[model samples]
Target: MSEAMKILFVEDEEALGMVVSDSLRSRGFEVDYHTDGESALQAALENRYDVLVLDVMLPKMDGFSMAREYRKSNRSTPIIFLTARSQTEDVVEGFELGGNDYLKKPFSMEELIVRVKSLAGCALNQENSELEECFVGKYKFSIQKQMLELNGKVKSLTHREAQVLHMLFEKRNQVLERKQVLDQLWGDDSFFNARSMDVFITRLRKYLRDDPSIQIVNIRGIGYKLML
Candidate 1:
C-alpha cells in the first residue's frame, strides 16, 4: 500500500482538534497535530509533510502568518486553511500568502477529505486530474483548446474564461463559491477582480445563451451555480 498522506494540522480548540485529527487518522491520513501556529510552524520546518491543514485562528501566530513563513523556505507543499470568519479579505490574504485551499469552519469531513485528496493527487472517487473537455446542455467545451461549440457554431474562450467555465462545469448544478473561484482564478478577490469576473460571467452567458436548458444563476452572498 502507498504511504498515508502526511498532514500538519494546527487548531487551538482542543475539542475540534481532537475530532478532526482523529477523523483524518481514521481515514488513513498521517496527521501531526498541534495547538498553536508557533509550534506548528516549527514542526513544519523541521519535518516534511504532504499537506498542511491549519486553523486560521491560533495563539502566538495566525494561520496566515504561519503559512507565509513556511512559504519562504518551501513553496510546493499544499496548504488547506480552516477559517471560521467569512470575511473575504482574510480569505484573499491567505491565498496571497500561498494557501492551496481554504475550508470554512463547520466544514464536513467528507468535503475536507475530497479537498485533501484532490491536492495530494491521490484518489477522489477516481483520478484527481484536470479535466480536458466537458459537455453540458448542448454545448461542448474544450478547455485545452479554449473553444466552446454549440449548434454548429463555435466561440473561442479566453484563458481566464475557459478556466472559469471549466470550474463552473466541474461543479455544475452546485453552488461554486465566489471566494473559492476568485482565490484560484485571479489569486485574490479584490473589488476589481470580482467585477472582472462578472464581465467574464456575462460573456459566458452570451456564449451559452443559445441553449435555454442551461443556466448560470447568480447566488447572492455566495457565488454562482450552473444548472443544466
Candidate 2:
C-alpha cells in the first residue's frame, strides 16, 4: 500500500472529534489530532502534514486565528476549516486567512473525505508538475498542480475545477461552448451535466473575482467567455 497521508486535526468537541479522527484513520490517513488552537498551532509548525483540518471555535485561540498565524510560516499546506457558522463573512474570512476549503457543521463523512482527498492530491503532487504556470489577470494558475494563487494566498482547486478553468483560459476572450466542456469532462452535454458545469463556472468566476478585470461571462444560450 502507498504511504498514508498525514493530517493535523484540531477540533475541541470531544465526541465529534473522536468520530471524525477515527473515520479518517479508518480511511488510511495518519491524523495527529488536537483539541485546542495553541497546541494545534504548535503541532502544525513543528511537523509536516498533508492537510490541516481545524475547528473554527476552540480554547485559547480560534481556528481562524490559528490559520492566520500558521500561514505566516507555511502557506502551501491545504487547510479545511470546520465551522458551525455558515455566514458569508465567516466563509470569506476563512479563505482570506489562508484556508484552502471550509466545511460547515453537520457535513457528512463522505463530503469531508472527498474534500480532504482532493486538496491533499493537489498539494502533494505540486512539486512533480513541470508545466509552466499560467497567469489570469492577477492570479497565477497551475493547471497541473490544480491550484490558483492570488497575492500569496493559494487555493487548491478540484480536478474538475482545474479542468474547466484551463479550458476557459486556453480560449480566453472567446466563447467556450458548454457542450464542448461537458463532452470533455462529463462525457455528455445532457442537461444534468450542463448544469453541473455551470456550477464550476460560477466558482471559477468567484476565484477570479479578486481581479475585477477578470470576468467569466455567460453567453446566454451558447456557453461562457473568459474576459481578461
Candidate 3:
C-alpha cells in the first residue's frame, strides 16, 4: 500500500478527539493527536504534516492562536478547523485565519472523514501543481502569462492592474479592504494612490461588464469585493 497521509489533530475534548483520531486512522491516515494548542503548535513547527485538523477550543492555546503561529512558519499546509462554534463571526474569523474548511459541532464521523480526505486530497494535488489560471466571471486570468482575457478579446493589464487583480482573484467574493488592497498592490495607502486604485477598479468593471454575473462592489469606507 502507498504511504498514509500524515495528519495532526488538536482537540481538547478527550472523547471527541478519541473518536476523530480513531476514525481517521481507520481510513489509512497517519494521525498524531494533541489536546493542547501549545503542544500542537510545537509539534506542527517541529514536524511537517500534510494537513492539520484543529479544534477552536483547546487548552493552553486556542486553535486560532495555533493557526496564526502555524501560518507564520508554514503557509502551504491545509488547515481544516473542527469546532462547535457556529456563529457568523466565528466562521469568518476561522477563514480569516487561513482555515481551508470548517466543520461545525456534533458532526458525524462519516462527514468528518470525508472532509479530511477531500481536503487532504486537494493538498496533495496542490503540491506538484502548475500555475492555475482561473476566471473571475468572464475575465480569464492566466497567472503563467500574467494576462487577462475577456470573451474572445484579450486586454493586456498594466503591472499594477495585474497585481491587484491577482489579489482580488485569490480572495474572490471576499471583501478586500481599501487599505489592504492599496498596501498589497502599491505598498502605500496615500490618498492619491487610493484614488488611482478606484480608477483601476472602474476600468476593470467596464472591461468585465460583458459578464452579467461578475461585479465589483464597493464597501464604502471598506475595501472592494470581486463578486463572481
Candidate 4:
C-alpha cells in the first residue's frame, strides 16, 4: 500500500481542530495537528509534509507570518489557509504570503477534503513528472523547482502561481475559462475565490512581463487567454 500523505495542520480552536483532523485522518491522511503557529512552524520546517492546513488566527503567531517564514526556505509544499475572515484583502493576502488555497471558516468537511486532495494531487504530479523544464516565450519554467528563469535571473513561484502558469502554458494561446481554472485549483468558484484568482492572474502578468512576447489576456466576462 502507498504511504498515507502527511499533512501539517494548525488550528487554535480545540473543537474545530479535533473535528477537522479526525476527518482528515479518517480519509487516509496522516496529519500532524498543532494548536499554535509557533510550534506549527517548527514542525513544518523540521518535517516534510504533503500539504499544510493553517488557521489565520492563532496564539504566538498568525498563519500569514508562519507561511511567510516557511516560504523563505521551502516553496514547493502546498499551503491552504483557514480563516474566519472572508474579506477579499484577507484572501489575497493569504495567496501573496505563498498559500496555495484559502478556506473560510464554517466551511464544510467535504469542501476541505476536496481542496486537500486537489492540492496533494497536484504536488504529487509535479514531483513524479519526468519533464523538468518548459518554456514560456523567453522564460524557462522549472516544474519540480517551481521557478521561472529568464536571462540568468530567477524568480521563485508559489505553488498556486506555478500551477496557474502550468495550466496556462498547457493551453497556451487558447482561452482557459476562469471557472475551469478555479474549480481545478481551488475546488470552488465562490466570489472570494474568484477575487483570489484575479490576484494570481495579475501577479502572473507581472512575473512574465520581462518577455514582451508573452501576455495573459483577460477575456472580460469570459476567461483569460495566455497569448504567446
Quote each prediction's TM-score.
0.57, 0.65, 0.58, 0.90
Query: What lDDT does the true structure give each of the candidates?
Result: 0.80, 0.81, 0.74, 0.88
lDDT of 3 at 24: 83
Root-mean-square deviation (CA) per prediction: 10.2, 6.5, 12.6, 2.2
The candidate maximizing lDDT is 4
Candidate 3 local Cα displacement, residue 165, angstroms:
10
Which regions of candidate 2 deviate over 4 angstroms?
122-168, 175-225
Q: Put down candidate 4 lDDT per residue, 1-228, tens digits, no spaces.
A: 188989999999999899989998998989999999999999999999989999999999999999999999987788999988888888889888888888878999898887887777653266666667999999999976789999999999877788888888888999999999887787668898898888889989999999999999999988899998
Per-residue lDDT of model 1, residues 1-228, tens digit only? 289999999999999899999999999999999999999999999998978999999999999899999888776577888988867677667666667566778999997887787556432212344766779789998766667998778776544566678788889999999999887655568774576567767777888999999999999989999999
Best first by TM-score, ranked: 4, 2, 3, 1
lDDT (10s digit) by residue, model 3, range 1-228: 277899999999898889889988888889999999999999999998878989999889999989988877565566778877767677667655656566778878776766666545532233454646887776787654446787578765433455567667767899988898766443468764465566667766776788899888998999989898
Q: Higher-lDDT candidate among 3 and 4?
A: 4
lDDT of model 1 at residue 137? Answer: 86
What TM-score, to 2 decimals, does candidate 2 have? 0.65
Superposed model 4: Cα runs more than 4 Å off: 123-132
| lDDT by residue for model 2 (25-89), tens | 99888999999999999999999998899999999999999999988877667788898986767
By lDDT: ranked, best first: 4, 2, 1, 3
Scored by TM-score, the top model is 4
Q: Any residue pairs clashing in model 3, and if so which?
A: 178-223
